[model samples]
Target: MNTAWIYLILAGLCEIGWAFGLKYSEGFSKLWPSVITVVVMILSFVLLAQAMKTLPLGTAYASWTGIGAVGTAILGIVLLGEPRDAVRLICIGLIIAGVLGLKFLAKE
Candidate 1:
């Protein structure tokens, strides 16, 4: 697998952590978790910038946001009991397709 892909995956995981952290932060009163969450989000963005060094900026950014949005939405549904309606599912599918399409275009 490409290093860029690995970085992107790491970025995605960081997004999940950061998204959860924002909820758990409780106005940033919980020191440790809040700090960790901020740090992880910063690191994720840094990794994203690094990945962009090789990948096209538009492609990298779009994929990063797409994955993060989809991941965070799924997390909200599973962990926070957010609704998982058909429209939301369709939107997620479209996001995934957009990410894949960008990747494929980059390969050409």
Candidate 2:
């Protein structure tokens, strides 16, 4: 509900965007995708910094990366036709659990 949390969530989503953009950019060979990726990457860092002003450093960083990893992995499976095996899904679930645990345990 806090603004810091919102910023953190948005930063996570931007992290996902940049990750996809990096893939589409093909090592920056593609102009537009590379530009977008750079912009989104900056935005993600800015938002993460904003959240860090309120959140504990460890909690904010871990949660941000966890969100990006989980989101990117799921999207990769759906959009990019990546693997959908049980072990992978279970691993993703574990990451989600860890992120949620960090969130709940965080004092702020």
Question: Which stretches in model 1 have alpha-carbon errors above 4 Å?
Answer: none
Q: Write the per-residue lDDT of candidate 1 for residues 1-108, one digit (tens) a residue.
A: 578877877887788789789889887889988999999999899888778878878788888888889999998999889999999999999999999888775672
lDDT per residue (tens digit) for residues 17-65 in model 2:
9999999999999999999999999999999999999899999999999
Cα deviation of 67, candidate 1, in Å: 0.9
CA shift of 98, model 1, Å? 0.6
Pairs that collide in candidate 2 are none
Whole-model Cα lDDT per candidate? 0.86, 0.96
